[model samples]
Each structure stands twice: as structure tokens, then as C-alpha cells.
Target: MKFCYACGSPLIMKDLEHEGEVAYCEQCRQYRFPIYHSAVSMVVLNPNEDKILMIQQYGKKDNILVAGYINQKESAEEALKREMKEEIGRSILKQRFMRSEYFPKTNTLIWNFAVVIDSEDLSQVSDWEVDKAQWFSFEEAITQVKPDSLAQRFLNNFLQEYKIKSKDFFA
Candidate 1:
């Protein structure tokens, strides 16, 4: 960070004990922590827990997990519900947090969860950001997501952890 968020003063790298090379504002006499946006992502499950909803956005062919940024003053759980309703037109019936991962390219810290939606709500309408969406079997979803992408990473990590935990919420 070149400038301080508090005083609008220039910041320089200063090494504090136990914290190496932090952005220090001379005018404010404080170390300014790094800033990043927080978001939420989901491995949205059907009520039967047999399938997951994936989406195609920005004209991309690869299907990805539904995700959106957490709004100001919104909890991760709140964002999860909001994103599901906004993007997939479904209300989350239940949710279980899996984990979080930070993406440098987007500068976003993403909280990942496994959420179940209403079983009777079969119809899905994509929002403007999402061009299309579809449900896939767990096996197919593992193979269908884009290779080496953030969505794929989050899905794999969550599934692996879920498996180790004997399918925490999905089971």
C-alpha cells in the first residue's frame, strides 16, 4: 500500500518486530493492515443432497460454483442466502461452512460453504451476471469445473474435507 487509508499520508515499508515489512504511515504513526474484499462461494446442493448447481457466467463455457461478494454489513451466512436467491432464484434451506481461500488475482477472500436448497424448487433462472446454470452429479461436477481454476480448487478442497468428515452437511 502506497498511501494510508486513515490520514491520506504516504506509506513506506517499515519492519516491526514479528511483522516484517509492513506499510507504515508516518503521519498516522501506525501500521496499516492490507485491505481486501471478502466474498462467498457455494457448493449448492439439492435438498436430496444428490446434485450441485453450477453456472456459466461472462459467456464462459466452463461451469463454476455460484459465488458473490459479501455486501457491506452482511455476514457470510447472510451473503450465502442472498447470493443463492439473486443468482439461482432459490432459497437456501440449510448451510454448512467448509472453509475459506484467498485469490490473489481478484484480491478476494472467499468463504466457501455447502448449502442445500429446496428439493421442490427445480426450475432455475439465471441472473444477468450468469448466462446459464445446470445441476450435475457429484462425479460429473468434479470433472466439469474448469481445470486449475479457483472454483475447481474450492470444490475439490471442500469435497475432500467433506469426505473425510463423512459428508458433514451433505450426508
Candidate 2:
């Protein structure tokens, strides 16, 4: 930031011992380090695990996994659960962290999760954040999903390490 948050003075770059060059406020004599926002991206699967829920937001062409930023004082898992509830009104039964990566393009650190959910029918639930939502079979999901994106990386990584754990209740 050009201006210091602690004081109304111009920030100057100063190198510290542990922290590299950071913004220093002369008036406040405090250093402000650059902050990276933390976000959560999830691979949500039905109970049978063969079908994955993909969502397309307004103005986005490719369908993506449910994702959102972790709010202040909220855990990563909490954020994932909240996003799932907000996006599709479905609560995650179980979730496991897949991997963590930093996207330099967005300056965001994303934590990926593979969440097990119970609901298959999403006809009754909807969210403003998502324009459309549907369940895609594993074959369709792997093909239709965009490659080189964070969601794809997470999905690929999850599929490599774990089996599709599902128990078809109705079918």
C-alpha cells in the first residue's frame, strides 16, 4: 500500500531481518507486510462418488468446483462447508484436504479439499453465486473440466490417491 494503515503517512520500503522489503510507516514506526488472501476450492462428490457436482457462475463458460475465500477467523474446512451450503444448500458429510498451492496471478493461496456429500438431487437448491449446477459423471467431469486450473489440479490429484468411495442409496 502507498499509505500506511496505522498512520496517515506515506509508506517507505524497508528491509527487515526475517521479512523482506516491507512498507514502513515513519510516523507509526510500524512495518506492514504484504498480505495474501487465503481461499478454499473443493471437489464435491456424491455419496457414491462417481458423480461430481460442477457449477457455472454468471459470465463464466467453463463449469468449476465450489470455491470461496476463507473469512476472517474461519478455518479452511469451515469455509469449504459454508461455500457448499451457500452454493447448493448441501452440507458436506466428510472432507479431506487434497493440497495447497499459491496462484501468483491472483496473489491468493488456495487450499483444495475433496468433500463427500450426501445429496444428489439439487433441483430444490440454488444460489445467486452460481448460475447453474449439475452432477457430472466422472468421465464427463474429467473431460469437460478445464485443464491447468486449480480445480482440475485438485481433482486430478484426488483421483490419483483415492478410490471413488460411494454407496448408492436409491440406485
Best by lDDT: 1
> Model 1, 1-171: lDDT tens per residue?
689999999999999999899999999899999999999999988878778788899988988999999999999999998888888888988888888999899899999898888763645666687888888988999999988888898889867876677455454
Per-candidate clash tally: 0, 1
Every candidate's CA RMSD: 2.4, 4.4
Off by over 4 Å in 2: 1-15, 18-27, 163-171
Q: In candidate 1, what residue range of length 10 has the lowest lDDT sum?
A: 118-127
- Cand. 1 Cα-lDDT: 0.86
Candidate 2: Cα lDDT at 163 = 55
Candidate number achieving the greatest TM-score relative to the actual structure:
1
Worst 10 residues of 2 by lDDT: 162-171
- What C-alpha lDDT, on a 0 to 100 scale, does residue 82 get in candidate 1? 87
